[model samples]
Target: MKKPEVTEQPGGDPPSRRGRPPEPIGEDVGVAHRTWLEPVRDRLVASGLTLDELVCRSGYSKTRLSELLRGKGYYPGWEITYSVVKALDLPPWPLRRLWTAAAREADKNQGWIENRIRAVQPLGPELPPVAHLGLTQIMRGPYTAYARAFLQSENRAQRAVGETFDILWLTWDEAVAVPDTPRHAWQLLRARVMSRAAQQDGHPDLRQAAFATVAQAGIADLAERKTRIDTMADFFDAIARLPQDQMDVIVLRHLCGVRAEAVPGIVGLTPAMTHTLDHHARGALTGLYLRTGTTVTIDTLE
Candidate 1:
């Protein structure tokens, strides 16, 4: 096909433009995330620091940091995002809100809020032990926290935590070398943890009957244990309904217990992009939990 050509306007005015038209609004799901990040990136550039200097200060890989500043990724975690803010000594609250808005925009594009799923929760088996004591010890706290956050039963959560360590031990050397940033170890552990959790749990679903039973019970029947299970199930159900990318951010960062700085690489994003996705996912969950008028404290991106 022949390409369109510029031509003189009527009355000898300037020629009409011939280049491709601008992209349609809303075509790019990442636009909002990028828009909010670009200004901070420009400020970073104007500050006259070398890439190595930025890397040294931020503890992010050169490539990843550069990509994030260049607005290349769609999701960045809170840790990385905050690191940038801290590195540059910028105000926190405003940028934090902008980061949250960006994630909201991205999530809206992904149709996360409206999508619903009915699923049967799957339980994963415990992972076998392996070597790499240093790393294993490091992962224990966060991994246990993640398991407790995700699995309803205390025993299952403990087993899932063990499984996370087992998977990491299996490939400890390879994981250690990845990105080699301060947060890399945590990221690697989180990925394996989430992967294992997914494998164990086939699907997460809302058991309305359980809730209904609770609703009809006497005040004495509302034990702390039962309340915890109900809350955990509601969280898991919300997670199951999230869009894939948003869900990944939630699982890896919140459930699997990866640091915000470590989240981008684990989830295949730049730091700023990871922040956006993390914010959106958490915001969604928070809103869902709030509908019941219960105050919830999920992990922050930072």
Candidate 2:
């Protein structure tokens, strides 16, 4: 009789399909969790390690691993996650940061997060200096300024930039592979900033940001201040309605006070494209203001 062929899982473990396949992760799972969880599931599938074998390798029971793989029940702490990640020979830092983000999204308290993190061994080596000095430090200023426009808190803006850098470090290889590294990085930064932005009508609500504008601050009379704010609110609402590229150009060039030459680099667009976006954005804002009969001009926003 011919012998049944046996396949080996990673780490020289024999494959065993004793347990049922992991359940599909539902939409109910937060995006942050799904970001890391989906990759883990892909890795598991690629590894050809059954749930029973994974339990042996990760030192967790089949039930626990199954729940984690499916993203069911309470969010699993970092300790179990680290074990599985190591068992699968996957890099931990990127997934660690992602897990931390998911934990915060889950409203897991800092103490709980810290305790869970401590239960695992210290993370592997620090991010290389090339990633830090070459890209992160250079982009930090503009990224933070852009983030501050939406977040309104210096600490929150800094945190968002820091998280963006962490993600960049983890995905540096893929970032470099792309046609435009800065554009890829900008998208990541934008997502992080937007995730924390105040929402209005399902978009980032920038009307409150008008209160912080120098135009609003210069007004002394309460009646005049209210009028300016109301006008600025309408202007900002129109800004929110602008197409995304044009909106980004207006925000960076006018709102964030970044130089025209710098705006192109930051948004990863050519100088000509950036200028066109600015012109078109200004024109759109002008049209909106004309329709609304507002006296405020786009130049005044500068």
Candidate 3:
């Protein structure tokens, strides 16, 4: 394909810049797309390379490169994507994982995905040893439980945790540089979970989970079962109203069954702070139960 002709300025700079500054990636874009697209855009901007230059290096036409960069039209295959990734000097494996996910989200078939990926040569380097170890630790930790409490699906919670680790791996350097690495990592995990969490009055809606509690009660009568469900829903709503730290404490300690000792590490709080938050959250829930005259026995809160 003939590349778009670039007119040279006095200093031999290409006149055509990265076409129209790439359309602003809005919330309408899927998370998978945003995950990879944002980094690619950042790398392009940081590299200070023009669209004409990218076309020359990627060996693709400017129009195709422009559309791919803007995330317009259909999803581009891995061949073109890897070409651009190489041209920008960005890490390949993470982008490959992210791109494959976005492609799947776009409804591309497995056969097509395999074919497209096979067209590109695989890169040699892998996630650093320390980052891999950190990923393993967080995976085995209470993150999935915390995620499951909000997401409510084993598959979704697992995906959220996996994606969080991928993001952490990508930003491992900056994460380690922070004063509190666990806290930084927790924030990333929280963002990923909350983005997909069901919302009620701007908080994560946990009412749906109340059914499980009601089910465990084994109340057969329809009227009693409904009352139990409603009461549990109210309790969950109250839990949702707690301050962020307290709410996290309640969810991790009570809903997720994470042990008191482990709560501090998972939520990135000191032992004292975790205990205080748990205490305050229980007190607040107890007060709500008392005021409403709900006769629910919460063993965990006790």
Candidate 4:
């Protein structure tokens, strides 16, 4: 099927967007890629194009595109970015000179670019650029994907803004995995099974390496206070895998620390059922603690 051509009405977006337009924001070409090109990439994302469609027209494979989004491979000559941006039916002339100069400067110091990416990633998960990617799979995602600018490293400042958003969400994912929740039962079922994600060996955060080692040892953390945190994480690996009903109860009881009286509003479980559920969860956690030797800060709970 052929795609129809759509035309832009007048001088672009009518009323000027308040604050500053994202162009000419920086002087040095290298810095401009991070500062200046941001708005350009953002303009593309605001447009409506699917990831797959964007890649096809842009000529860069999905994998390469992903790296660029992560701020890893933004060094390719202007032609590549040009092809991708132009396919959206927008002009790329003036922007070309800016980014072109940025690319040449980028070539001189590739290592510094990746280090900047590392600086913005949060403490826990760091999804690196995919390795061992084939050409076919690489071309599947959008290059100038107007949508991915949401996920892309558009620029350092923009990425810093995004990392903040992830921090809040991660806090919640952590809160929900507590074992006193009916969700804990689901976790006990898989304690030893899910402890194999050792990819954090190269992780920049010490906690990551520490946790990965804990999981591999079937022990979560050795430090007493940190012990509860890690054990909670271990239990969550399994709880997170449970059915929705059970996970909901887990969150109600443990994460939010809601009492049995409030369980009905959240999970629709009767008061009697919630009480029984909490009792069994307590017993399960106590028994697991004794058996697994997962330690917590001494005298803190005493």
TM-scores for every candidate against the unseen true structure: 0.34, 0.82, 0.82, 0.26
Over the stretch 147-184, how does candidate 2's per-residue lDDT look in tens digits? 99889899989878887876666555557879998999
Ranking by lDDT: 2, 3, 1, 4
- Candidate 1 ranges with C-alpha deviation above 4 Å: 1-132, 180-202, 205-235, 243-245, 248-274, 282-302
Between which residue pairs do clashes occur in model 3? none
Predictions in order: lDDT: 0.54, 0.82, 0.79, 0.41
Candidate 3's C-alpha runs over 4 A off are 1-23, 26-28, 47-53, 218-222, 297-302
After superposing candidate 4, which stretches have Cα over 4 Å from the reference? 1-30, 107-302
- lDDT (tens digit, per residue) of candidate 4 on 1-302: 12332445566854432222222322443553653355444544545455556688888886765555435533644455566556654334334434444554567455543443344323233332132123113311221121122122245323333222222122222324453322232232122112222222331111232343344455434675366456555654433333434544554455434555656533435677766665655555556556877653211121
Q: Higher-TM-score candidate among 1 and 3? A: 3
Better of 1 and 3 by lDDT: 3
Best model per lDDT = 2
Q: Tell how far residue 172 is off in model 2, in angstroms.
A: 3.1
Estimate the Cα RMSD of every predicted model relative to the unseen true structure. 20.4, 6.3, 5.8, 17.8
Task: Give lDDT: candidate 2, residue 122.
Answer: 91
